[model samples]
Target: MATTTERVKESLLGVEEDLNMSQPNRSSFMQHAIKDEQTGEEYLNEQGFINAIAPEGEDYHKIKRDQYSILFNVADRNHKGRVTLPDWSVFNNLLAKPDAEYEIAFRLFADPTTGQVDFNTFKEIYARNKTSDTIPFNWDSDWASLYLGGKKHRHSMTYPQFAQMLRGLQGERVRQAFLHFDRNGDGYIDPDDFQRIIQETASHKLSDHLLTNLPTLCNITPGSKISYANVRAFQNVIREMDLVEMILKNAINKSSDGKITRVDFLNEAARVTRFSLFTPMEADILFHFASLDQPSGRLGIADFARVLDASWHSTAGLVDQGVSGPSEKPVVSSKTFLHDILVSVHHFALGSIAGAFGAFMVYPIDLVKTRMQNQRSARVGQLLYKNSWDCATKVVRNEGVRGLYSGVLPQLVGVAPEKAIKLTVNDLVRGKFTDPKTGNIALSAELLAGGAAGGCQVVFTNPLEIVKIRLQVQGEALKAAAREGEQVTKRSALWIVRHLGLVGLYKGAS
Candidate 1:
């Protein structure tokens, strides 16, 4: 027996299926151009914006409408109680830079009076951020000829024209992609073939919903191909995905479960979102069709992202990520084992150098302490040194400054292995327990990592300490050496290790 999904697939085709996809729970998408009371000119409000991108059939694939409830809030960003063309332009960084970054940069490179920059200044602008190793910008290059009106030095550009030039570069590439699919140069690309261009350029950045439904809107019959003009409009919407996502994210509180019911999303988005790109109906329809996973309404950022963005998924899974805690993390990391090992090794190397340096600085003090504890004197008056300072000074005077650092070799050597092993063990273990999504570890996992590191440190540190003690005690004070013909043979680190043997070195390890 065929399943209902299989029967639906068999029965529905093209326009019929697309129409059925339109949600009946909300008002049908009706385009009503808003008139600004002061200007007496009708401007496209949020409804018009959604219509431009979504078209007639399969409106659920588009954004939902706030059903006139959220319109005033969405359109009021321009202060004219509407979303002006300039507001859209600034949000997209089209026509002009919002922060005046490129404008200020232009002024610096251009003549203030003429408001124009010559070919030299233009190349200088390009070169300002380039490294010496980067290929130099050539005025005669093919890209420069196309973008800068040939190689002529006579071609000077102002900030307004420069902004368009920068903007057109991306559009030109999209056009080229569209043209590639338009094999006959008929100015139309097949819906299926045109999708290839979007897949190539935008798949990684665009949401799955937009990519699937956007091409279906381009059916103009004859051959059911999408026009270049329609493709251009679609391209424009793709550029605004970032701004739309930013606005949508702003509407929801991340600290919550991150799920907003359909009405709540529309109303909340009304409060937070700028510009009138989505109507209440449009948003409601999207919430119905687009949200992916939910027992409490599937309207998480990921599902909303199916309508909104592909850039930053979300904070918590439902909002951006999870409800109460991190839930989106994969059990295994994407990083290769070799990569994790290399990263651990890098940190361990840095830690070892730091430990060795610190140990070297304080080794002399350790030498004095070792000597003070080891000294044998029957009477209090026959004591070689009274305190830490006296022992340090007496050793320097007797042993010609080198005696105070008698066992520094083993101390420094010991520190390197101790730090290296401890850090490597901790890092490897932490990497195992860390949440791949957030890179955070649980409190229990952190404690385990630290304990593992400490356990590993004993392997190298114990033998090193044994060798260190041997060297420190070998060096004698001047008064101790004053006994005639009483020779105290000094052993090097290698000699001590050789005599102690592998088993003997760890004798007093505990």
Candidate 2:
């Protein structure tokens, strides 16, 4: 019998096969795995796990989450919440070299007190190793100072120190952003410098008030100059506004063309902000401002900055003397709400209309195809019609033009609902599969939606399709009955349904 460690390794190898991951990738994934505190079972959290194995496209995050869960479950040897060191050691030995580097990494992740590792510790170690070939194990190293430092100089970080470290990271990011805008090696940012930076980095322009009041807003006494100290004081506000602008630009510039069209702005804004912090109305208003004074409806970086500036000040209730005054309230238009509703309904409406129109136009050809398919003569020469044209000609000549349209009314009625259901259900199913965090749908979700829609539409379409096929084949049957001198009765859709039961309507549903 296999040992517990061996069983865990086997399970992990099976998961590796299931994920189609190479040995190196598998090792990397396992390195980030952490044991749950309550259950002692190994598992990877969804966010970090996704970055390791996620594929491209909307459903990538979900696929990563599922694969990670499977692998974690496999490595949890005792079916506990956490995977103990013995189980992980077995898995690591199978895929990775048991070198000094590996030993150091393991120690950094394992808790000194409990001798167990969790995802958070694993993630820290993994990130450190990824950035540098050598592990920074020295207590006095910059890495250690950045992440582990506290008043007492403990080996592990306390909660307050961790929070302080995160704030430091954010501050570093803001400082870097501020440096990017402070051109010409200047310690201060003037109106021109701000404008130039906004033009370069964003797709909108800074509002007049935001530009004029920047010095005052940053707590500069002169109201004309912005110093580094002032920027540091207002870094959080600047970072938040910059993040919003970045989100907008990324969402709009789908083609990477350095500009956004009005249509692109609207569509991408809806998608990016669907589950983001920004409300739909706010997104719409930003798009509106970005499109202002631009008849071409294409906005560049300056336009994006202007929109961001307007939105930020409006939220803060700041008045621009030259622009919208303090007395004027920010306008919240209902147009975006209507536009969202319209977008939701557009696909269903288009499908219904197209289905109705296409059915009406190609119905005669469908009649020919059905009639040709239904003919069951073993000998080719005994076939009802030589070809499609011949079949169509004979039907037109023998039954008149109206005969070809015998079942068209029911078909027309069914086509609209069938098409509508197919398209609507597909969208709905896709929405169900969307990741709540990122608002992305997976390819599997799309395929499943399409299959579900096709199956659902068949319920409404089977009866009409059956009726049409029967009517198309009726002309041949009538001729045969006449030639045999037998009394023949015409069968309508209702008559067939009554005789064969409702199941007859779904003759070829399978």
* Best candidate, lDDT: 1
For model 2, the stretches where C-alpha displacement exceeds 4 angstroms are 1-349, 376-380, 435-439
> lDDT (CA) for every model shown?
0.59, 0.56
Worst 10 residues of 2 by lDDT: 318-327
- Model 2, range 236-312, lDDT digits (tens) per residue? 33445665666666755565767775456446655765544544434443445444545455667665654355333
Candidate 1 lDDT at 354 equals 88
**On a 0 to 100 scale, what is the lDDT of residue 308 in model 2?**
55
List RMSD in Å for every model shown. 26.3, 19.9
TM-score of each: 0.39, 0.39
TM-score for candidate 2, residues paired by index: 0.39
